[model samples]
Target: MSIEIEMETTTMKIYDTEGFPNPARVRIALAEKGATNDVDFVAVDVMGGEHRTDAFKAKNPDAVVPCLELADGSHISQCTAITEYIDGHFEGPSLTGETPKERAQVSMMNLRAENGLLNAVGAYFHHATPGLGPDLETYQCAEWGNKQREVAGQTMSYLNEVLADNAYLAGNKFSMADITAFAGLAFADFAKVEIPQSLSNLNAWRAKVAARPSIAG
Candidate 1:
């Protein structure tokens, strides 16, 4: 896709690593909003410690991938913040939410998926497994990592329970919460965290989300 671009405007810039989980979230949001071609993408050499550099930190204190730079040169980091910008700026179905209740619900579910699943899996990968190798993973806490792995599994089960009644996270809409949870499951798969065979609702939800044009295409 194509999103109609305003005249004489500089395309916004996105600094990210392709195929990485968090970056994929923003990419999906862009695709969903039909704004994939509206911005310029700048690849960050994360494995080379590019994100940790002082220059990169100037753009984003967190030094994370999927950072968004506005046409005027202001920056927004963190996938959630970046997605919020995309959702509000671009014309499409709202990812965060459209109303007060919807927004609050989406935010709550997103955090659940982020903290309990995605971040939990991340903790396991970075702290327990040989994540990003020794160069980037300077500190490791195997015990804590192992504990988070259990949390990830438990979150998966919780999501399954939620999915039992709704089509997506935060209710019938495929909001930002769904995106975060989807990415979390993908991360879990990459980290070799076993998703139990019994969570049929979660598995079905995953299959549906995966088939969306933004992801399948």
Candidate 2:
């Protein structure tokens, strides 16, 4: 199903670090909208503290990657907002949702995947593990991180239960929720969080989402 009209275009740019989970979310969203080629990808020196510099902070106060720069010089940060922009600006299947109820569902599931899986794994990585080394990881909280690791495991089981009834995280239709959950699982693997082998439905769903052209290629 086609979405919004392709607007009067310009060289939109995305500042990100390739291969990172959050960046991958925006990248997949672009591919889904068929606007991957249209946007200019500007690499960020995240490891060297480029993302923390004053100029970068001006663009994104949060100092995170995958920030979108519009033709009018406005900036949009966070994967959710960026994906929403991409979904509405380009013509393709709706990523957010086609209706209000569906939109709410997508948003709800996306948050669960993000907080329970993605960010949970991230906390463990940056806190419990030697994430970016001492230069970047200025703070350490092994206890909190270890607790979040448990949260991640519990969330995976909950997701498995949800998947037992629905083909996707939100429902039958693929939406932003699926994308968030997919990226979350990738982060989980990177963080060395054990994915329960018994979660057959989640594993099956992961394989299916991984096969999509936006991800497979």
Candidate 3:
């Protein structure tokens, strides 16, 4: 006999952007956990200052990308929070982890990648490039931006070294940590930051992750 599993459908409103990293991370996570169709996509134009508007700030005071507005009028900011919620509530594969030890490892790796690698890249972009052409003067700290780029490059090298033997950043399975790293790395490319060819393991792993339908979606 075959057993069928039923999953409750949940509708979510996602405030996102097409080429942004933070939003893409949440989008990719939703795809990995098969929660894409459950969400209503709302594109917030970051370049147009939509996120900085009062209306957007009411939903998220931080005015950050990838805000999740629930049907209950509750809002959740931060890509990690949204992904974690989906991983916990969704009925498919758990991206966070199954066991206590596994969860800890996954969280640890994910945090490291976000803080050390992703944040560095963000700093590089905000301070160096500042795609906000007219608002470029808002970030003229070229010295700081250059420093951040170097830091991010170093962090990528470190991550590549650590991921040499591991199939994924957290451990053997493809968890949220890998997703975070991939989003960060992808964003870095747009920022004109190049990942060293020496990071062959990371490149290989990225290729594997990129092949996922969710990523393509």
Q: How high is the CA lDDT of each candidate model?
A: 0.95, 0.94, 0.86
In model 3, the worst 10-residue window by lDDT is 130-139
The total of clashing pairs for model 2 equals 0
- Write the residue-wise lDDT of candidate 3 on 69-104 in tens digits: 887889999888889898987788889989999999
Q: What is the TM-score of each candidate against the true structure?
A: 0.95, 0.95, 0.91
Candidate 2's C-alpha lDDT? 0.94
Clash count per candidate = 0, 0, 0
- List RMSD in Å for every model shown: 4.5, 5.9, 5.8
Evaluated against the true structure, the overall lDDT of model 3 is 0.86
Please provide, for model 2 over 51-81, each residue's C-alpha lDDT reduced to its tens digit, 9 standing for 90 to 100.
Answer: 9999999999999998999988999999999
TM-score, candidate number 3: 0.91
* lDDT by residue (tens digit), candidate 1, 99-213: 9999999999999999999999999999999999999999999999999999999999999999999999899999999999999999999999999989999999999999999
Angstrom error at residue 128, model 1:
0.2
Residue pairs with backbone overlap in model 1: none
